[model samples]
Target: MQRSDLLYGLIDLFESFWQMAVPLSAQGEPTDDAGPDPTQETRQLLTYLSGGLTDGAIARELGVSERTVARRITRLQEVLGARTRFQLGIQATRHGWI
Candidate 1:
């Protein structure tokens, strides 16, 4: 595999292990999405993701757990019908989400 792809896989593997080590009941910081505007956390996550940061790195930057970063990514993927992070970044840029 390409080095980039291998690094991505390794990041995901480490994130999975981190999540498993943490409590399943641990909750992420609450976000306010009541308005039409995107929450700051969401925007930050997108920015980090667009910059090609791994979930762990993004989580550290956002002061949240990797699981929380993964959850936000899943939500964004569903909202944008994006099958991958690259697609999500493209769609976000198209819609000016980031």
Candidate 2:
């Protein structure tokens, strides 16, 4: 399969696992405190990164500079206590954040 197709499949699998692992409330919100509203951007960045997007691509998609993306990712890592992108992805998966 193509890379995009593979990515989509992985995303679908992750979504399914997430739904099974952490059901949403009747109001359609996650039960846990993933973080504050200001961290929404960090969550988006993590999602994009998990989907295999590069910092340059994420910067373009988010309409921000690559430097800003890097900085935000660093801050996200700090907040999540993730030592690496792989760890961030794992933490996100475990916390049902994606």
Candidate 3:
């Protein structure tokens, strides 16, 4: 075969192998549609909180006020049903957020 044909055949073989190696999971398994939005403050807050940052620090990093950070954290706790930052961290970890 020509060199171009050989490369095309190799590409097809790799595509087949990739398709076989990554099968979809079972249906109705709980997917990750509940996590915080990537472009939102809640996700950033979770990241900072998990990284052991203070609320003031997170506020500064996010370019928002400390009170806003506190309020966002409070809302996040309510959404996750977490009573404390530790609990929020655990939940976020379990949800693959941090």
Q: Which predicted model would earn the best TM-score?
A: 1
- Residue-by-residue lDDT tens digits, candidate 3, 1-98: 44798889999999987764412234533233445444556677888988889989998999999999899888766665567788666656555566
TM-score of each: 0.61, 0.58, 0.58
- Residues 1-98, candidate 2: write the lDDT tens digits: 44798889999999987654533354444445657654577678888999999999999999999999999888766655566788667656656667
- Global lDDT of each model? 0.72, 0.74, 0.70
Which pairs clash in model 1? none
Whole-structure CA lDDT of model 2? 0.74
Candidate 3 Cα lDDT to native: 0.70
1 versus 3: better lDDT goes to: 1
Which one wins on lDDT? 2
Span of 10 residues, lowest total lDDT, candidate 3: 22-31
In candidate 3, position 32 carries an lDDT of 35
Candidate 2: which stretches are off by over 4 Å?
1-39
